[model samples]
Target: MTDGLEGARERRVRTGEGVELCVAELGDPAHPTVVLLHGYPDSKEVWAPVARRLRDRFHVVLYDVRGCGRSSAPKPLRGGFTLEKLTDDFLTVLDAVSPDAPVHLVGHDWGSVQGWEFVTVRRTEGRIASFTSMSGPSLDHFGHWIKKRLARPTPRRIAQLLGQGAKSWYVYALHTPVLPELAWKGPLGKSWPRILRKLEKVPAGAYPTPSLPTDAAHGAWLYRDNIRSRLRRPRDDCYAHAPVQLITPTEDAFLSEQLYDELELWAPQLTRHTLPAKHWVPRTRPDQLAVWISEFATASEPDAAGVPAQLAAPRTGRYAERFGGQLVLVTGAASGIGRATAFAFAEAGARIVVVDRDAEGAARTAEMARLVGAPDAWPETVDVGDGQAMEKLAARTAAEHGVVDVLVNNAGTGVTGDFMDTSVEDWQRTLDVNLWGVIHGCRTFGRQMAERGQGGHIVNTASAIAFQPTRALPAYATSKAAVLMLSECLRAELAGQGIGVSAICPGVVNTNITATTRFVGTDEEEEKRHQDRTTRLYGLRNYPPEKVADAVLRAVIRNEAVVPVTPEAHGARLLSRLSPRVVRALARVRPRV
Candidate 1:
């Protein structure tokens, strides 16, 4: 009786082995079926959050594997949890749920291990439509991986083998007789919730259901019955028949990413996703999991989904696996860097929220983004400098589209002239659009991301002028410098919450910002001339905004802190750190403008 699966419609199915499995179903039966399986020590409740999110579109089903949750444990409980018995139980459930249609299968940890068996075995062929696996690998695949490494053990292969062996310490522990059961049923079980909270960042109240002790106690046989036999005699013909989606958590302590490097050979139709969380992604990243599952499952079937093959295979662009099906919001997306960033994310299959003060331009960007590859695109009109407007936008975005996974605060107003020459109006406007816009964005959307508890990224567009301060551009430098400092401070603050903040210095890119730049202490005609001249100079520099956009996406993927996009920006950054006095001396030199 966990809080996670409260609303599910429950039933029981007796397997051929005389084991009764408890099943829960949600959503319309007419929709595409998505069946979720739980891992060791976990039951159907582990899929509750993900199930809830998918119910609207998918006929979502979850079931307690035999010997876990409310399901009756095997009479002997020794060899009952073997892969053979598990497959029998799965086929029984599938026949009962959707006898006519194949199901989209999703699994985590031990469940994923079982899924690898189900997808590869010839007996279960044509029963599964697709597989989404996380945190676990096929024992056969793992065995072959080890054998390959050991057959010709190089230094790198030996290191990898040893590293994975170290991570599998629990596997060895689980194979011990009686000790595992005793620990799981006693003090370890009692303290399991707290341990998960402290170590895995798993939220309390919903997981580690009341049957955890018994479940964990009985689940030890999963390793004892299978790990040794399968590894010693791995099957040669274990190729998958259905499309497979592998979701790897980069921070998973229990599993190494190296385990899946050869996954493509086994799964001919393979799509990969990289998550930034730890082991318990079901609890920590349910929303993202649900989105990816829905997208891939739909894309896996052209006829059942009515989506064209070309459109369905959306995760084909650079870094597509990381950004596909994610929600990305880009401010000032009407033109230049912001628009380019939105398009880059779009090409990688992310849903784009195009925002700018220019409503028509934002709409245009969103439209073009959809044509590129974005599953969905939205145009938003907002003045980011207005804190209230930003707050409202955040609330509305949450209400309508869900929380943003990535945020790009790329809006700015350029100001120029000496410190004394740049009037208060110029400073205020520049600060409003540049500094205050980023502040408001970070406050509003960043709060949503933090509250969601799932990881996210924020990219703030600063400039080379931020680090290499110039007398000719005092107000602009001050605002951008403030932005850089704020991004650094915010990154430090959000580091604990898995939210990354990046400040990008793009330098003098060939963008329209130069055309709109205001030259303080100049007549209207003089300002126009200066703007044209600066725009021409930047055109001669010829740095494309698309490259800056690529850097923004790369920074998010790498979780970088400070990124300098242009050559000039990188050199200025180098000078600022290595020799500040030299940079200061250069800052004093008057420009041609």
Candidate 2:
């Protein structure tokens, strides 16, 4: 056993930047890979034991994130040190080392903050299999949390000022012009530990400033610049969709744990743990942290690669087993897509509230939802187009179920008549149900969901038509388009509040929607004939609504903002984005059915 450390190994690998990271590898390379990122004022040595303990079963890789111990610190440029640049640095290292595969990731301190940043931004998470964050908060949430905690009158304000002042010394030094030259050339060479310890104790009111040169300002400036740039731009521009695990220390003696209050805002399925330790968890609690990392690494399944059955289906707790116990309210829950969606959520074990304007049809759907295996289900005949009715139903549901964690705003009406044939009422009605109904549900229930302070998911049903409007159904398509924009706006607004919004765009689902469309028909026979012709011309195939329902649940857990339900929907979204002119031309050319 080589005296209790036979499995340990280390090597040095140069990055694309030509900086050599003292890479430490533990466990078997054949095992699933897990990468560990260490924060500033520390080096890869911090994760030594962690790598050792996990080496037997995981291909654990530990390295300094950048500009830390045993790694080179390049001079900062205008675009350097940005989060995007930092994320690219991580990716560069990962590609150079784990080129053929994705790996489970763990980061602590500054590294964790970067990890938190990477997971919440879309471009970065696709490459990560899973993430574990230690002492990191969603940056946006942390800023808000800190401001709120420090905003009170008197004592709290005094405390905040004191804390901010203490931190400001380092912050200001970086902004100074000659700080970098001084720190690099001054007599305080290699005094990193002293500097780190002083900052650590000062924030907790335990230490006095030690004599240090203003030259140390260079490093401080890098941090200040990064923080400023980050604040100016929100994470939504870069948010990634990756499952996360967060671990906090009880006695960090620096940043407050309050920064992590609303972590679900970034990753809905976030799992958290708090350990009794200090800022140096990689050094102080390596063994314990290693155990946690190993479990998470093995627990997450790789979607693109072959993940073992044991790891993919890792058992959940008794509590997790009852996920279906939650109540799922879906609007437009009568026929067609809505009916299929009701059945889908029900199959997942959620209690269904089948809501539609058609009382009798909604009741039948409620029964069908139960038959589909929902734990318990019911029906509500409420016109979604009616704002007051929506508020009342949302309030009553919250009162009855205690909470509605998942809300699918699926109710909608369409018209196939030409734009010239559409009246003001027709346009307004389309807008009322297709656009305003979604807004009402979001605002009325969204406020309550936010107030509850629990994680919630809202899926608003848009249409493929939203991506490209046809002249024949201008009112309907325009309303759906407006709904799409609204969903995007809400997703951004609610991200920091732990409320998720997903815009679901489904292509034609085999539903009886055409029969219900408000058209200029003189008689029942005419209406039926028109509906039949519309369906036939559209080449409508009845897609099981259950597929969309499942996708909604998955999107919620993944915290995804967009849900395209079919290949046609995906193609429409792509065309709208890549070649709008072509999309418009195609839409304009389609003859009225």
Candidate 3:
């Protein structure tokens, strides 16, 4: 065995056909094994990112399939790359690495296609403990999907078939005689990395290896040898014998989400996760994939009782399909809209980070978030207006919880007074919390999102007063207006980086801000009276903060630039744009003291 990446032990496993397969292993031999299989036109190097992540917790292994990378190709190239031969190669590796123990399996693209064959076959049962598949579907299930659709072709079914057929255009190209090999040996192989970077947003690095031309030329047999025969006579008894986890990239160019609509029929124990990403998740989303793989593999381990391992139950939440397993950070999550937003994302199965100046309140919110359905939740205490404190928080969050997938900057203070009555201190305080707080969040967390190169979203809580002017609320309105403009500018700047920025404008909702609001140019007794009166009026309006929370999720999902929450907010926004004079006239009416 030779030493490779991170002191990985490298060896060779020979198949019965005398083909040498290159295998690399990391971590302790005594630990549970996790075997990672690469896909078409790629080598074991494609799994380097994911393997590095799993090595600490499990025995991670990666191998190049025959005819790719350092693996030796079979003698007769035409009938060399059949699925049965691939299965034999997998079995040989498993027996050589861990003969006494079952191994957890992970596959991407064509590797996933091969894994479907492994876990479903009776001869391979009990040797495989669990399977995690991505970016590929089972040929048998696909065959059944097509047969059912053709047997009774509804309009929706026809559309799905046509859509998938269009996506499979490359399959036809690969099936051509000698053309694919020529293309791979010529210009196509040299430009493959550049094409992946431009089209799929795969990060540029030392991947696809120097032998890509030979690898791809030989990989064409993967499609030509299996697809036609399997689809025509797919096995009827193809059911998985182990717990299965399926991670689907929602934006994969080669596969449609509809392809797995009836997957439950084949796999009785199934857990599904969706990622808002394109193809090549191993390169772009290795962190998230590693986390999920570790969780599934750990759950599949048998207990001391020697009973069969029980898989985790699937997450059944409203937005689980969109945000499950993602990290979300909500600032000012101690009360009002911020706390409600945290709870909403938690209910969607996202991990939550609650940040607020009130340490106890933040901790309480984090605890409640776990009960609601968050996989995990943590609390961080810091005043959003404190730039240094926010910078520390951002660094700690990235280091501990990974890069935040969604950020909600909902911290603000209420100020009500005439321009002259509002002192300079009051103006500075409001701007510090309302305007500068949002700036701190976007600058700190948004920079991390940009650096990570994966897409994310930022939500800033502006107010209806941003566009609708009022004489009694000058300082508060100005601060909120700046937030709205900042969100717009950031949205335009970050569009190219795949980051989304949204300004949530709410009119009036019953919350605690009114009671804490400052009244300028008033005695202590008079200020107390004004606070009670304003709180009463807002309570009578009776708008719930939960509604605003719902709008925040919608804005992130749709990547909306500006969203008006309340009905009055919508009307006010329209009036401000369509009839400015009418809006100004309405704003002239002052609130009663």
**TM per candidate:** 0.89, 0.47, 0.89
lDDT of 2 at 324: 45
RMSD for all candidates, in order, please: 3.4, 19.8, 3.2
Of the two candidates 1 and 3, the one with more favorable lDDT, higher being better, is: 3
Candidate 1 matches the true fold with a TM-score of 0.89
Give a tens-digit lDDT track for model 3, residues 113-221. Answer: 9999999998898889899999988999999999999999999999999999999999999999999999999999889999988777776766878888999999999
Q: How would the candidate models be sorted by TM-score, starting from the highest? A: 3, 1, 2
What global local distance difference test value does model 1 have? 0.89
- lDDT tens readout by residue for model 2, 1-593: 12123454656666565655555566777777888876643455556556666677878777654455444554654344556666767777677557777778888866777777776666665567788888655555555545655556577655765664564464455556665547644645456545444432212111111212222332344465576556444445434466677777766665555556666765666666665446666654554476557666767756445542233332232222223445678888888777877776776555678899999989999998778666567899998888999889988986554457678898998776777778888888888899888998888888876665444789999988888867767888888888889999999999876788998888887666776787753366877788887666545565766677677777877878888988899999999999989988987774645
Model 1 residue 532 lDDT?
A: 90
lDDT of 1 by residue, 260-296 (tens): 9878999988888888778988887776788789888
Error of 1 at 394 (Å): 4.2
Show where candidate 3 strays beyond 4 Å. 1-7, 27-31, 151-158, 381-383, 386-402, 447-454, 492-499, 514-516, 522-542, 574-579, 586-590
Better of 2 and 3 by lDDT: 3
Error of 2 at 173 (Å): 36
